[model samples]
Target chain A: NAGVIQTPRHKVTGKGQEATLWCEPISGHSAVFWYRQTIVQGLEFLTYFRNQAPIDDSGMPKERFSAQMPNQSHSTLKIQSTQPQDSAVYLCASSLDSGTEVFFGKGTRLTVV
Target chain B: AQSVTQPDARVTVSEGASLQLRCKYSYSATPYLFWYVQYPRQGLQLLLKYYSGDPVVQGVNSFEAEFSKSNSSFHLQKASVHWSDSAVYFCALLNTGNYKYVFGAGTRLKVIA
Candidate 1:
């Protein structure tokens, strides 16, 4: 399996611009997770979806960040009005089930300039 | 709320030396503990996991972790280290109730020859 696939290994967006990151989960996996990683904040959970449905997004910034799992195969995270503080590695992960081992994709590094 | 803590922010060890990376967690119910490693410019890879039964669990690359319910800790260990083992190690706890992973502030390991 290709594991989880995240598009755009790197992205650079001007401040106030919007950025959308894509993630294609492994086949047959029922759970998908998004996390942000930076030197200051090790790893922070952003949101998650189960079977194409958003389960919890408590960690999300809420104001300018949003996530959607349109189908079983893919999900997307969109950040509006990006700022330098938004720069970080966005990681996507999937698991066979909620309680199973999670496999991660080579994250997309978002650099807001 | 479930949480994880990795006390050491960075650790350095010589090749062939033994190593231990500490982790402590807080959760009310039985947790699914995991250790993941992140190489430079790469994604997080699962090293090991523990749910129940044996307290000591084995993982990839000669790595192992011992879980202690009494102490609320799951510490990763290696008998001998190689330079390739240098990476950031993260301790995570999976909350089965919500199926979300709470991660620790990772510990960076630098193996020197």
Candidate 2:
């Protein structure tokens, strides 16, 4: 099924630049989730979408982070003015529904220098 | 606040030995619990989950987890481990009102031959 596909397995960006991570969910899946993982914070939920509609983004940073699911197949997470603190593994996951077992993609590692 | 705790940062076990990884969660109500494993350079995969009906849930690769509401614990176990089982294991919780899954810091398991 190709599972979930995340683009650009590794990304390096200059501080203050913008970074965009992509995720294509599994076929027939309806729920997509974004998370950030680091040595200090572990895994933190950033946002989630259901059926191409934003569900909850309470975990997203209030200012520089935003996410969008333009269609059922894919989603994007954008970080504006990326900083050193934004350097982490950005993971994308999807599920049949909110309560279903989620499948994850091999996250994109973001390095802000 | 909803959270998950995996006290062990890393664990080493001899191949063929029984394995047990601990997980504890904090939530006011019944929470959906899950165990996920991540191989090196790969995304997390569901090992097992427990919602209701069964205290012990069987998952792929002979993995199983027992959910205890009284103790607020959902621990993963395996009767016998193999070298291929080495990976980082994570415990997650999903609240009734939220779609984002709260995750623990993760326990890295190393099975030595």
- Top candidate (lDDT): 1
Chain A TM per candidate, in order of listing: 0.99, 0.98
- Among all windows of 10 consecutive residues in model 1 chain A, the one with the lowest summed lDDT is A37-46
**Model 1: per-residue Cα lDDT over A1-113, one tens digit each:** 98899999999999999999999999999999999999998899999999999999999997999999999999999999999999999999999999998999999999988
Q: Can you tell me the DockQ of model 1?
A: 0.91
Across B1-113, the per-residue lDDT of candidate 2 in tens digits comes to: 99999999999999999999999999998999999999878899998888899899999999999999999999999999999999999999988787668999999999999
For each candidate, the alpha-carbon lDDT, in order, equals 0.96, 0.94
Pairs that collide, model 2: none
Q: Give the TM-score of each candidate.
A: 0.98, 0.96
Docking class of 2: high
Candidate 2 docks with a DockQ of: 0.88
User: Candidate 1 docking: what grade?
Assistant: high
TM-score of 2: 0.96
DockQ comparisons of all candidates to the true complex: 0.91, 0.88
Model 2 agreement with the true structure over A1-113: per-residue lDDT tens digits:
99999998999999999999999999999999999999899898889999998989988999999999998888999999999999999999999988877999999999999
